[model samples]
Target: MDNETLQAWVEQVSRDSFGRPFLHQATFNRRLRSTGGRYFMRSHDIEINPKQLETFGREETEKIIKHELCHYHLHLTKRGYRHQDADFQRLLAEVGGSRYCSALPGQTKRVQPYRYKLVCRSCGMEYLRKRKVNPAKYACGKCRGKLFIKMLDFVLEP
Candidate 1:
């Protein structure tokens, strides 16, 4: 969506979901490759990754908006807005927003917290991996069958 449309959407969502008005700008940032969207602390503005909408569609993008709104509203009200904050967690869960900022391409450091994982097609075993490996070249450790990759969200240390 264009900037004008995005701004309107953000404002509408703020009123509908949080009972607050979003006074800052909201625009799509093509360069945001690490997550679905972000709320700038300095500007109180919101940025949505265009890739997020291209990949995940409108519904998911709306969730990302909700996620960013949680940050915006909480921060403006002087409540907890950081991901680890109890207030942030509670508001996020209550709103059913994305638990983590969703990932994007070329953002390796935060791409996937677990560099690797193995899922057994037969037994459904999930193994967390810290190092990357060729999924096609490896077999499930538990079933000795083909394995699938399961990436985890990056969790910053408290």
Candidate 2:
């Protein structure tokens, strides 16, 4: 749950699974949202997503830690450490690590609404846009006429 316990667990997993000692630090990274864990190539440190533990519990989190450890051990030994590499894949399978982490519920990216619209005054052509743009910087493609921007109103229906 905490950093210290995570560090000890990572070291233990490294030794038990890979027969290699994990010398680097392992900490719970609160900022990690999309992935279960990350391995730093430069620092050789491992970061576990705390949300994974809270969501999936210890069993799934341990697999994520093993996944990171695969990268750690292979990279340090000058072996194939990337996801596509044969060595990494073999090691991962041998350790029974998870190939991909599951996405957290309600973590999907929000779709941006079309908040603005560009209108051609001459041709009455319109373009829906998600971001606001300067009307002076753009021209209407249909008639090469002047363009004006308007804010679109959203009406929520029951």
Candidate 3:
């Protein structure tokens, strides 16, 4: 979703879940990598990762919004807002918000390192491998066919 829709979503989520209004802006930052969302302390604006909705869909993104809102509302109310804070954790659990921003498997945006991949043409199976492999050295476990490798785009989620 674009920034406009993202703003509306954030507003709705704030009121519906927290019973509070989000006066600051909510935007989508394409350059945001690794984290699911960012809550700006200076501007009090919320920035969400666009790839999140495109990859994981609305359900996951909403959870992310709830996660960010925990920070926003808590910070505004002068409560413990940091991830390590007790109030933040309690509110997040009560609201059923995501504990952490989830990273897509095999995506380069992942904080966890991914070293390789293996694809089986015969069975059309794609695998995320943690270490590099020689293509011709091994065959598909299921059909004994050659394997191909690809670098992930770090776009959509599984």
Candidate 4:
């Protein structure tokens, strides 16, 4: 949806869920990554990730709107608005907002597997390492045995 519609929707949701009118701007932010929405403390403006709507549709997007509104309203009223604050938690639960802002599709960080392994020649103990390291510098924690480094050729599936 367009910014106008999003703005209207945010205002309506603010009124309906929080019983407070949203006076600040609400817009779709294309540059937002990982997070589904954001509430700017300085401007009191709310930015919704357009990718969220495209990926999850209106039902889930409404929850994200609620989440941002929780931050917006609490921050404006001089109450605790941060994620760790009790007031924010209470209001968010009352409004039925998403527990956490979900990452957009294909926006989650990928984990790289270990590229090397250190083996204890005397005790058969093994240690996985993310990067190449000299085995001569370290000894096995259990047996203090001599160690050898082995490069791994593991591939990660998408």
Candidate 5:
């Protein structure tokens, strides 16, 4: 949807859910990623991730609008607006807003296993590392000795 439609939707949601009018702008922000929406504290504007609508459709996108509204309303009223605040959490739960702003598809973070080890030449002390490191830049903590880096073979468990 366009900015005008988003603005009207946000206003309607605010009035229906929070019993308040949203005076600021609401727009589709193409740059938004990971999070479904964002509420600007300073401008009091709400930005929805356009990708959310494309992926999840209107029903889910409405929930995201509610989530951002919770932040907008709570912050404007000088109440607990942060996600950790009781007021924010209670309002969000009461309105049935999404717990999280829903991650975009294919945007989840990946975990990398340790593939290298730093071994102290003198003491044989070893430190597992996820990335390659220059041994010359670091010294062994136990004996302050020169360290050498070695690749480790990892076997996946069945």
Candidate 6:
């Protein structure tokens, strides 16, 4: 849906769920990656991630809207608006808002492979490391002996 539709939806949800009118703007933010929606404390504006509607449809998106509205209403009224606040939690439960947004599919954190390995000279204990480090500055934990560094082969993707 367009920004205008989203704005209307947010305003409606605010009124229905919290009995408060959302005077601030609401829009779909394409750059939002991990969050379903965000509430700006300074602007009192709410941004819903468009990907959420595309992925989870209207029902889930409404819950996200309610979640952001909880923050919006509570913050404006000088009450606890943060996730850890009791007021926020109680209001969220009353409105049936989602505690946390579902993680987007295929958005797992990237894991870097070990680029270097440290081998102890005496004990032969080896440790894999993501970054290169000076082995001379460190000693082996198994035995107080010298250590050496070796670069591990990385498989390049085409």
Q: What's the CA RMSD for each of the models? A: 11.6, 3.9, 10.7, 3.6, 4.1, 3.3
Return the candidate ranking by lDDT, descending: 2, 6, 4, 5, 3, 1
lDDT of 3 at 94: 91
Residue pairs in candidate 3 whose N, alpha carbon or C atoms collide under 3 angstroms? none
The sequence of per-residue lDDT tens digits that candidate 1 reaches over residues 1-158 is 79999899889988988888999999999987667888999999999988888877887888899999999999999999999999999998887788765565555573534555668887888777877666788787767888878665664231
Among these predictions, the greatest lDDT belongs to 2
Write model 3 residue lDDT over 41-69, tens digit each, in one string. Answer: 88999988888888889999999999999
Instruction: Residues 122-149, candidate 6: write the lDDT tens digits.
Output: 9899978887899989999899799999
Clashing residue pairs found in predicted model 2: none
User: How high is the CA lDDT of each candidate model?
Assistant: 0.83, 0.92, 0.86, 0.90, 0.89, 0.91
Q: How many steric overlaps are in each model, in order?
A: 0, 0, 0, 0, 0, 0
Q: Candidate 4's residue-wise lDDT over 60-141, tens digit each?
A: 9999999999999999899999999999999989999997766765675878778788999998998888878888889999
Model 5 stretches with alpha carbons more than 4 Å out = 110-117, 130-158
- Span of ten consecutive residues with least summed lDDT in model 6: 149-158
Candidate 4 local lDDT, residue 66: 98
Error of 5 at 9 (Å): 0.3
lDDT of 5 at 8: 94
Question: Which stretches of candidate 6 lie above 4 Å from their native place?
Answer: 131-139, 144-151, 155-158
- Candidate 4 lDDT for residue 135: 84
Any runs in candidate 3 off by more than 4 Å, and if so which? Answer: 108-158
Screening candidate 1 with a backbone cut-off below 3 angstroms (N, C-alpha, C), the clashing residue pairs are none
Locate the minimum summed-lDDT window of 10 residues in model 5: 149-158
User: TM-score for model 4?
Assistant: 0.72
Count residue pairs with overlapping backbones in model 6.
0
